[model samples]
Target: MSDKYTFLTQAPVHRVIGVMAIPTIISMLLTSMYNLVDTFFVGKINTQSTAAVGIVFSVMFFIQAFSFFFGNGSGNYISRQLGAQNTKDAEVMASTGLFYTLVFSLIVMLLGWFFLEPISILLGSTPTILPYTRQYLGISLLGTPFIMGTFCINNQMRFQGFTKYSVYGAISGSIINCLLDPVFIFGFSMGVSGAAVASVIGQICGFVILLIMSQKEGVIHYTHRRISFEGRFVKEIIAGGTPSISRQGLASVSTIALNSVAGNYGDAAIAAMSIVTRISMFIFSVIVGLGQGFQPMCGFCYGAKLYDRVKEGFWFSTKIGTFFLLFWSVVLIIFSGEVVSLFRDDPEVIAIGIQALRYQMIIFPACSFMMMANMMMQTCRKTIRANILAASRQGLFFIPLIFVLPYFYGLFGVEICQPVSDIISLIVTIPIVWSAFKEMR
Candidate 1:
């Protein structure tokens, strides 16, 4: 047994969480910063070009869905195995996840390239935006394997309690991407294609870094011999991973739905909504990083049957996450227009985005509880309950609301759908979390 993980089971809950979360928070913030950088540079193009990136974002979310599926699925299992002192199973899970993610991502890349035009159209790109979308999406898909592989490797390292290493990979990639964004976009005159190329190269850097780090002693090591295609191993991955897949997959679906609905208002509306989504995600990343910091603890304590510690960590994380989100929500509300203007200066985009951003912020604090509940369930291996909670926010609620609300209220309906869904998901989360805690008791 490694002495490194002793703190997870014995250290004070708050201290353990702080140690794990700070690096993740930095990594998440940097990741969001580079994404904002992408929007910043791409916004310098035209509104149509900005809208094109918005349209392609749904496709990017789809790719991320699968990457997270494999990463979290195997990561969840690995964390518990390590907790139970089953190093052999942990290693197999690691290898299986990386191997399968590579194969599946390659297949997705091929399919994405083969049907690039239709895929772009399907993501709600208008005729004007279609050309830029193709240019960006075509190049972006080429890095699917690396992006997916990086995600898997990062997750495994994180679950193994090697969060600093994960941070190193992620921060390095974001720094590289940010540096290259301007050079490729302006210096080389590559435009949107330049941004896509920079992104791919950045992902490649992170992937390489993570791959090297994963091989270090006391971390999960990937080797050809550990790869397994057996049905049982695959089932375990699917069981553990389904929540992530459902959550991310629903996000992709909801984004597509959002883009399509917003498209009715015009390309400006789509662009405005895109900026709002990016900014909201940037703010929400802090909460997510905190939740992620709590996840390995949940897995380890649960596996070790330290139920009290699990519960303690959950509440502590929730309180901290809520406080930070509330603070940011106020900041965003106060400067909604200015924030929206930072991305694009169009009067119409600013008008649409300001209202949308405020509406989303109304429920930002609720997400702390919702996310912690989901993460707790997932880490504790309550797969079905986790999936239900995961799917509800975007899939069951947001999807229906997106279609239905727009019918009655039009643009306002579209803007408010997410906040409404978030509120209801929070309502649903209370009982689910309560029940899980009861089980632990």
Candidate 2:
């Protein structure tokens, strides 16, 4: 047995999870901070600027949808391969994922530039927000290949249990983004365009670092030679990655729907909801990071036929994730107004955001469970169950709710839709997870 993952197969469950999860949590927090920072600096320009960034976020979601599709899909398979002592297949999967991600991202970038104006309009950009939206979206689309590649490399590293490498890439990029946001947004007077430039630079930086790290001898290396477009490899990648595709793809759809619905009210409504969404994601990153930490462990254990260990890791992650989310939910609930005001202090923005933020916080703990269950299912390659859970929160549940709730309750319905979806998702998750546990038994 290779010393690289003997610890995974032998270490105490708590220690294994902690060792894996902490770096991921930090990486995720840093990544989420970039979005918050962008929102903050852009918010200083005006509500329209902030709202413009929000509109462009739908595009960002689209980028991430495909990125995660490849990243998680390839990463899951690589982890299991490593667990089964198949390094050759793991390398092939890694290279294959990176190759396809770059290719698809290029397609998205071209398509985005081709329909830049129409895309902006479709994303819910108001007339006043269009110029800023165009500037941000145009520059951002240029970095799509780099952004997608970075995410793919990061996920590959994490699945190989080299999450520290993943952190190096993510944190380095976030730091660059943070440092440049002020420089470009105000120092150079680039406004929203500056924010986009800063973001692209940061993503490029991370992409370079990940590429370097992936080249190390013992780590999962990506090579052009290993890049195979063979049908079997492609099928496996899609099969393993379908859950992430559905999850992120639906998330993009939901964001677009939310933006369109919120746009009806005003830019303030869009900005308010946008700020709340970024803040909620910042808090939720901890849960996601923890869940990611659990992923390789689950993948490794399940691949090695250590079903009991997989179950143990799942429950352990659930508890830790629950506690962390509960704690943050309290903090967010208590300081909802202050938190929203930090991004945008306009009274209207703050008022609209605070209530929505609190509603999200109310059901935040439920998200921990749903997220954990989904991660476990995905890691174990429970495709159908995982895809169902992945699609439920944002796609299956939230999509319809976004349309229906706003009709009866007006703006408040829009505000509360996500939390309501989250609660229902939790209910849906329990049975699916229970069934999986029984199967493990």
Candidate 3:
């Protein structure tokens, strides 16, 4: 066995996961922080501007959905192929995934520009927020190709355990975005358009840097020759990646539903919910990082039939993640108002943001297991169960709740819908995870 493969399959589970997770954690944090930075700066523009940013998030969500679709699908397959000592298949699949994402980017950008205004309106923009939404969403659509490409390559690298390079790209993009945000927004006087421009520039930079870094000795480099149109490769990608697409695609729709419902209350409600989503996302990014660390290991150990190690990695991550989020919950809950105010100081915005933030945090820890299960199941190639689990939180549950809660509780229902979905999703995942472990035994 190759030294790297042996280390991955046999290393102490904690040590392996811990080492792999650090860069990914940092990458996810920096990426997530950029969104918060956008929210923080745009909040200063006006509540309507903030609401516009929130509405555009549905577009961003869709971008990420396809990116993760290629990323997770090819990534999971690459890790397993490498584990089984098949470098040629891994190399081919790597390029194929990126090739697919670029095609998706072209389609999204074309359709997005063709129907920009109507699309913005469909994303739940109020008349007051529509202009800003168009500005932001226009810039977002322009950067779709670069942003989605960056995300796709980053996932491919992470699954291969060469996260060392992925972190550099994430850091570069985040730093540039941060520096450019203030210059464009306040210095250049571009308003909402400024944030969008800065963000896209960063994605372009990250995409370039990651392409360079992927050429390092151990990482898989994308080559056109390796791009395969074979049915088997496509099937593997679908099996592994469908969970991400399901999770993210539904998340895209769910955010649209969320923004649509929040708009019913007013711009303030939309702005408040937007702020809460950013803050909660920042916290959830850490858990995702931890699960990502576990993923390669899960794929590797399972491929090698080292089933016990796979289980160990899963439990180890779940325990650490639950506690980590639980601790953050306490901190965020205690300072909910204070944190919400940091993003936007409007009294109405802060009031609504605080209530929504606290509601999500109340059952926040439960989300750790749900997320980890999906990652684990997908990595192990349990497609059907994983897809079902992936669909539950944002799709089957969140969509219905978002519509129903507003009918009964008005704004309060909008605020509470997500956590309720989360609670029920956790319940659904318990049986799936148990059965998976039983099968492994």
Candidate 4:
């Protein structure tokens, strides 16, 4: 198909974007629910179990950062190659990415299993939470390669503009996870460990689905024939992926910091914060879904040197994401207590979570802008600004704010730190946005 006839080119931008985004959004929402399921099941075991789930959550994010680093980096290159009509290059990139993800995930899985204690502690596990954390991490680690490979293939599919198929893989996993959670966690009385096991099984199933899809679509080749690694291509992938690494990596740090800060308030506070994070993430997934829809469009346009189209995609995505997030944020702020109480009914957990949720909601719409900007930059291979903005929200900007604000203002400060950091990050993004606009024009 000619550029003018392509889905990214000829279709009504808004309708086409929605067609691309809705499945991705549904997938994101389902994935978010699994995290909620983690909390819900673990919460039933006791608050400590819930807190343990929270600690292990950070460790999982750390693993995902690496996964995303390769998945996104490779996918970005492949998308551009496709746009440039270099099919062979796209396959090579996808193959190399899969190869790397498998190796990396195996090493991580072994390390997580062998050093569960230290790993849990590093992720901010309190001594009381360590046992549960270890069990949860151990189970999840067993499926690390599957999860990592799934993400890599899913990214490739999305880059190829096969967003619906990517959604199928994610939804299949999430539905299985949702179905198994109660059986494993309560029916068998397996507790936190069961929840982790359910997640592992779900990820493996999802991995199989994605693997089959990739092969049939010819997106990735699992050939025995050796493919020479192009040093420059690897470098490009790393460079392109740096933003995702920073975004997710800093998120891991933020999770640890948030847990440590909440720990000071007691296990109830930790549990409440964990629930709040899950709730907020469920909403944030919509923003991610829309941003992802914009990614391939931006990449393809940029690759084709259609700078105007790239600019249009960025702005249009930003508007759509902000509108949706704004509406959701309002609902969350209005129903903060109800949302928190859904996971755990404790009065103390509800009280702490309400405040956190309210503050987090205030920043949601603004943060959507940052998401759009970052995704656009990544797709266009604008690495430096992308990484800086990506790292800001979680790492440099939020970490110190979280630490210092909590000390001075108590629990309220801790709750407010994320929103504050988000606003500041958006401010920093303004210049990058302007520069991109000027360049594109």
In order, the Cα lDDT scores of the candidates are: 0.90, 0.91, 0.91, 0.83
Output the lDDT of residue 433, model 1: 93
- Candidate 3 vs. true structure, TM-score: 0.99
Check candidate 3 and list the clashing pairs. Answer: none
Q: Residue by residue across 78-151, what tens digits does model 2's lDDT show?
A: 99999999988988998899999999999999999999999999988889999989999999998899989999
Q: What's the C-alpha lDDT at position 148 in model 3?
A: 86
Query: In model 1, where is the ten-residue run with the lowest total lDDT?
Result: 1-10
Model 2 C-alpha lDDT versus the unseen true structure: 0.91
- Report the lDDT tens digits of candidate 3 across residue range 250-294: 999999999998888889999999889889989999999999989
Work out the TM-score per prediction: 0.99, 0.98, 0.99, 0.97
TM-score-wise, the better of 2 and 4 is 2
Candidate 1 per-residue C-alpha lDDT over 113-149 given as tens digits, one digit per residue, 9 for 90 to 100: 9999998988888888899999999999988998899
Question: lDDT tens string, model 4, 238-275?
Answer: 98889988999889989999998888988888888888
